[model samples]
Target: MYIRKKKNTSGSISIQIIKKIKGKSKVIESIGCSKDPDKIERLLKKAHKRIKELEPTLFDSVKQEEQKLKFLPISNEQVIPIGDELFFGAIFDRIFNKKTIFQSVYKANDKHELFKALVISRILYPGSKLYLSDYLFYFKKKEISDEAIYRLVDSLYKDEVKQRIEEAVYKDTLAKVGGKIAVCFYDVTTLFFESESEDDLRRIGFSKEGKLARPQIQLGLFTTLQGYPLSYEVYHGKKYEGHTLLEALLNFQKKFKLKNKPIVVADRGMLNDANIAFLENNGYKYILGAKIKMLPSGIKDKIINLTFIDDNVTHEINIHKTITYKQDKQKHSLDISQRLILTYSSQRAKKDKYLREKALDKLKAKIEYSTNLTKNDLKLSHYAKYLDIVDDCKVEFRLNHNKVLQDSKLDGLKGYLTNDTTLSHKDIIEHYQNLWHIEKAFRISKTDLQIRPIHHRLEHRIKAHILISFVAYAIYKEFEIKTREIKKEYQISYKILRDLIKHVFAIKFDDGEIFPIKLSEVQQKFYDALHS
Candidate 1:
């Protein structure tokens, strides 16, 4: 048998192992095909290896026996496989190249390659910069030192580079969404650091992850209704979540120069007088969560009395209120009309009741077991209102049945405040439901991407780390969209797809020859989906 290199019409070389039988050439095994000269040479070598395995001569058999005997003393643990590259990394690298918004900011060179590698690693294997060199060497077969990575990160934190990236991603996303954004979603999350020290940017605050002792920075993200990220901002950890909305929104609008104002949607945390006035005074429509219990007694009573025939029906109440806000050291008031859309769900009601009962049970246990209950304990517990403390020379605690009854009356009811009168109440509710998309984005970033517990001490490096995670999330969303489009019956999750890609790797020889392992049926389907 001999190795054969055949030229295909597509201007590529196909290597195969051929044998001669009865004066006719028969293809024994088709090794592979490639367009590059180096890959073609590697394929030729693989074909030769295939020929030796198929028809072994006396010398080849002796050589195989010698190789087996040479490694006889080595145990399985010592026989480590080296020089294997992650095929999934290559797939994601291709995806990153196609969706990257940094080409205009950074040139195509080692720095750009390192940036791409960092973003891809954030998705596949998130860790510290110290491991970056080893990660790149294993995945891309390239050498990038830790100091080079730190330098690139510092450069990435520049205001010019950050603005350019945001603009590019915004334009790209706008094009993807058909050049118009009628509605958008905004949300904020906290990313804590691993150290106990505090700086200008990193300070201790109310952490959503319950890491109150660790210093954290707040991240505000703006995304399309479908959860495609448009822009992100890193704020000081101690800033109020509500205060971040206006800055992020104003900056995004000013930078993008949007002609039409998109309706902003956020949860109750962003419902503040200043935000409402800013959205209204600037001619921007908004959908914000309303604190039903905190409303005026007259309005609250009216809402609690309204009866719902079924879950399908919704009740709408018109509210007119004057909001006072401060700007330029001047106080101003604006009177605005909004529709408070209230919906009832049995599932939601059950969840609310379960949570309240759980909290009450814990409060009761604490009161019964502990003899000395300090006022600080009551101050820290949110369920303190459900208990009445009597200080008559001795403190006594009792359950407030009236407060629990009042809360039960409002169970399962959710309110959404909107200024858009054109859309129907059902449309408003449906639009508000899309807020879950942003929540899911945060979940993926915190868990799958591992974006928190930042180790960088410098402010610029922390910002750079967040920027990498932002870009990584964009690519992840694209992958999710593609996988959904490819498989209509059932969608493949990111975790499953990642595992499959992990198994599809290539072996690299000392002479720069690569032999890709055969792909499973499902793996091939997924691979084709990405390549296609």
Candidate 2:
């Protein structure tokens, strides 16, 4: 049946709902002439509903769906969560199975599903593999031994399986969010171990979180400008972070088969003269954070003298013309094409001076009390250069006010370096500023993925543990993309989203039909958003 419009004698119009049966055209219903099209559409809907009610057999599906549009009244409603071990896992599995190519990369085996269960368990509650099975067995009633998980992770380390997974994830991310792998933001972080002694992989290094004297492993993470996980590497605890950049990036460039000259953004720690040359040689462009305070005396004087333009929020940042420098280093000596950008903020200056003075005050107390001064105590005091130490005879010190005043000149300014001279200073500044994407990614990995406190001593197992979290993180990223930004409207925190998936249980009655319990209003909104 369809709508029909007819013209009358007075040039008036009439609309009717018509049904064609075999060869006959019959008027199912008719409405008098109306100027409004919306009124006619409402009449059409009412006519269709009446027809469906009169002929229920022809519209059973529609009737049932209509009933679902409102709540389905159940005489005997029982919410049974026992059947699915975790509805949450089922939701995670959908994201996991759809977004990643893990299954195709590795052959399916007897314990393949169990391997996935470990990943889901980690997302649900991150903890040791040794105790995961116990909780799964008693609380979850899903039994997979910890040794099986150990052996599975052991297999991941064999034959470059972890590398294969990383490769597969890279391919999947590109396919999902299509473009060449461009604009990568890189950063390094340290993860400490709980063990008392140090090993080769987990030697004591400078901890990012200040877990001093603890055995820690450094993790170098790479991500897109949008903070999606791309690739990561684990290095020896005491290994210089500046040295890891060349290897990690070269391996990534080689393995992922990224095309020529993708832009790499990194912080100052990753911006050494050698690494810069390596990047330039490899046909990769980089926008790197620069230690302006540590710059050569000549360049420092030049940069701090530039006039800042803080007129508009969009145009407030100042950018200088391209700055070229001569590097007469032992290994890397060439006329480098570089740009130095200086950014200033009144707020940052206050914070910077406040922190420097705070550290100086702490050093004053330490010099008075610390009888046994060591290298570390000296390192903690940033103003130690200004101190007149007469500790050979007795612990005594005097502060050099001149040096303190000199250091205050560079309080508000920050610097960045980029080799891509083609881009405007604004573009380079914007790209460098997006380094926070990788920073946020590290925060999620460390806090949400709990990629720290190496619970496993075996190197392969440790690698596998990171891989599992990596895959979980990929799923999380896809989820965030789908959900977009609706926290204000939905208040859908991870806990809420997890609970919504976890508590989505069903009841199966005698007729062998499953009925998911009614969702709360907010839950329904989230469900719609997830699917939408």
Candidates in order have lDDT scores of 0.80, 0.70
Candidate 1 lDDT by residue in tens digits, 1-532: 8888899999999998889999999998899898999999888888777777789899988988975665455433332222122333453454344334355544546666777778777776667775566557655657866787788898887777677666666776787689999999999999999999999999999999999899999999988988988888899999999999999998988888989989999999999999999999999999998888778878888888999877988999999999999999999999999999999989989999999999999988888888988667777877788877687333467888988898788898999999999989888988889999999999989988889789999998999999989888887776666556655544766666666654555544444545464677776665566556
Evaluated against the true structure, the overall lDDT of model 2 is 0.70
| Per-residue lDDT of 229 in model 1 | 89
Model 2 bad stretches (over 4 Å): 1-50, 53-55, 58-109, 130-141, 309-332, 366-377, 388-398, 508-518
TM values, all candidates: 0.76, 0.78
Best by TM-score: 2
Query: Can you write out model 2's per-residue Cα lDDT over 1-532, one digit (the tens) per residue?
Result: 6677777786656777678899899987775575567876676676667666545564787878865754445433444543124333444455445324334544554445665666666665566775467436533556776576676778776545566567666766776657566688888888888886887788887888889888988888888777777888889889998889888898787777776556999888886767877776677888888887777767766665666565222212233332332346443454466777677777888998998889888878888788877545675555677677665554456888877776777777777787676887688889999988777777877776676777888887887888888877776676566666655666666666655555655665546566666776765665566566
In angstroms, give how far residue 469 of model 2 lies from its true place. Answer: 0.5
